[model samples]
Target: MTARLDSVEPAVRDPIRIDFEGWSIEARAGETVAATLTAHGIRGLRATRTGADRGVFCGMGVCQDCLVEVDGVPNQRACMTSIDRPLRVRRQRHGQALAAEVTALPPATAESLRTERPDVLVIGAGPGGLSAAIAARRAGAAVVVVDERRYPGGQYFKPLAVDGEDVAPPDAQHREGLALVRRALEAGVEIRTGVMVWGAFAPAEFTASDDRGAVRYLPKAAIVATGAYERGWPVPGWQLPGVMTTGAAQTLWRTARRLPGRRVLIAGNGPLNLQLAAELLAGGAEVAAVVESARPGARHLGALVAMAAAAPSLVRDGIRYHWQRMTRGVPMIDGMVVAAIERTAEGLAVTLKNASENGGHRRFEVDALCIGYGFEPSNELLRALGCRHDFDAEQNRLVTRRDGDGRTSVAGVYALGDCTAMGGARVAAADGAVAGYAAAAELGLPLAPALEREREAAKKQGDRHRRFQRALWTLYRAPPYRIEQASDDTIICRCEEVCFGDARAALAEGVIAAGPLKRATRIGMGPCQGRYCRPLLEALLAQGSDRQPDEHSGFAPRVPVKPIAIRDLASASD
Candidate 1:
């Protein structure tokens, strides 16, 4: 028997009500406060002084879009947050005062006494992040750099192994990153790898809990260079174990030195896919196909041409290599999309639908599917701080408005790197340097004319890259048909194992919002959390409930911001 909405009695759930600016909502037991507010049509729970209304975009704790003040704490990600107890909620537009209030009263324990305030706190140890820390320390600021990864490098400088031993190679990008790490350490930058900054509150205090345990960092200013993640795309069999994002696959190969499969099919739109494919092929993996969704004469041709002209050698080499593969009868399917993937006895039989042919389909047997569209800014921490964002419809990114030097709307807070906007690694590092100097200047340090000159150079380089990125984005935009291709049985949220059917059922039960459905279905509460799945879930639920994707309310804000290890907390003195 199917479980009907009314047949299942509403569990005697505790009700937590939040009163926002001119709005009010009640969160059911175990529901996130953000989700609860979103369920009740509170789209603009917070508004900027410019009157720009904002809410959660990425339901994952990564994109900080759904930050709100809970009982005086500013910048808590509403997605990972739950309303376990009664609390006050407010809309914050700027400053860390409200955010600081929340952290001031974090259920204090014995370990809380050890919390040390630094002069400068840097979240994320990527090229930009590490550079910023090193620069700040050299400028006489007491600096502390925290990162979630096991090592210093963020995305650009990934750790790799050689000869059964983990060695930082001098030629590797991460080796460059290692140099920054070493410099920062030598310059007295306290580095804490494997630590995640869960919250950034007012009075320049940030909460980071990791292997050592939860610690409060009270810095004069903060630098956020958290970076970006691969955008999620919906397709059949995407939930399969062997199927992963191109970035994830690269991480596996680069970091763990593990092949995704014996035979791999790389698909999606972007230069990253091609670059990754070439890397995989060079790494001795059989690339069965490189399926791209873009048509040859699509828009953004100007930018593509410019890129080809600028990097003639790279373009020539890429063309030469791909031509060789094609001459050897290797499959390179353009204007095609993966329709379905079925696990066969041998491997994965991927059904290909070619747009050029009517009702035309082809199949390829491969062991893995490496898929990704592009990158999206990971802004959860910033959003939690109540920073404002604008939806860049072209790139499909919710970008925070920042000064020329990467200062966000919030004073004393700065954002740089791919986290601000998806420029490549070079742009990220350059932006980090600019932000570092700008932040120091903001702290009353004299500005060097050379630093301003470097900023101008960085801006020009960034502009060029951004133009190329826009063209690339247009080239690799997810086809409209991909959304229509989702099967009713397809599971969107792998963490909660929630399928399209479950999402529809939630809508039918009057959930009709992203927040409530999350609680009812646990759609965004998994290991990777909603980092990869939130956008898909949002689109699915919006369609199911007959609401525009952007119109849907945001997620609830919660604390203990990042996932903490039980052992780490247990080891901390009470």
Candidate 2:
């Protein structure tokens, strides 16, 4: 069993008791139902179809692994739902809600759906969307900002739990994000939180839902800053209870104010892993080790030199992170990858193998494993809107077409932030400012001279950030052979329980692309809508056939980017 920190106090003064799987537990007000469960070391929130225990893998609403039946509603995202009153909660199995008390409980009627006709609608509340909304509002355009998370911060600026001690220390990036959000609100931007945007009709029409039923926003322009999700890689035992993505682990500490486990292993191929190690150390969790698949060599030298001359602050930040890890006695191992994982008698056992040399492996035992190779932009909304996109080979992803000012292929639509490419916070903010100014100007709002100057300056700053992004991609790019490390028996898609062996067999039987492979082996047909497995599976198929990722094509996403309550859909009006 996992242990939780009893020393830390709950954020709320007033608390309520709730029933969890027949066991009553104390929960604080303003705490997410998911956080309440984690604080008590309840990891197995649900069980899969194969009888495997599943818990909070992404913590965010993106991964449906944390679904729980709340008040008789089936398939509710526990991480997004807050505890307002005494509620009956039960663990879900497959798609079944197992609460015995739920006998013909009717859906709670919500208030009339709020409709808005803002001049400009910002799709995300992170640095990008906030900056865009601020700029647009300053130029006299009525603006509204919407985000899926309850908080205003996007992933990078995600707000920490309200604890006595600061969950996150004073950082420039966090400060900037907060300042942007404040300025946008002061500038009269209407901010909507905890809204899930399901569908987008071209030319600025969106169908979304919140606790208040369904809402539609008919804006003259829209800016998409919906950011990216942590990329998932397949390996044996990845479906186990203790396994989670790197972002999920960070969310555990940052949002829930609790460590994921007593002992944890961090593995991935990016700078985020280094930062996560430092974070874990601060959160009072034992860092077993950090395994980095990318090896530092001459290829990264040019990018490093360019960044040093262009953005010394970014370079210094990286140095300071490593220094913190070194002082804490955390081992930073490079040129290594997680070859396989399995549940042992003690806990989760991970096999670390050399990325450069085959047949070399080392074993480590830990209670939890946090793994992420990189990030894939949440481009489903843009794709579903029919925005033109082309593949970027070096980045190993597809980016929505946008000019320097965040204009997309479709008119009245703009794409910004990491979704455009992983350019971090500063770059996203700069680009967002430019987009906001340009959008306002296009909408017939007269921009002041100072705002115009700021727009130009923002463009120049965005260039520097883009340079840093280029260096970042060059420095920690995933090796081609890393995907080949998955054993034949490894489960690739946890949603459908599709194994790597079955996918390989389908490829061997002349399945050339993702479309054919899906039909042959049911790879991408699952509850997650291929959010977790499609990218890795597509890469594997491409590598097996020696074709590029774009040649294999991408998965077509359907409406409702996230899973919604059936009652909410029924309540939505045309």
What residue pairs clash in candidate 2, if any at all? none
TM-score of each: 0.73, 0.90
lDDT tens digits, residue span 58-88, model 2: 7677778888888877687787777768889
lDDT of each: 0.64, 0.78
Tens-digit lDDT track for model 1 on 386-488? 7677766565567778988888888889888888777777667767776777777778877567666765676776665656555555555555434445677
Task: Please list the residue runs of candidate 2 whose C-alpha ends up more than 4 Å from where it truly belongs after superposition.
Answer: 1-12, 26-28, 84-86, 97-115, 165-174, 297-302, 508-513, 544-546
Please list the Cα RMSD from the true structure of every candidate, rounded to 1 decimal place: 15.9, 5.0
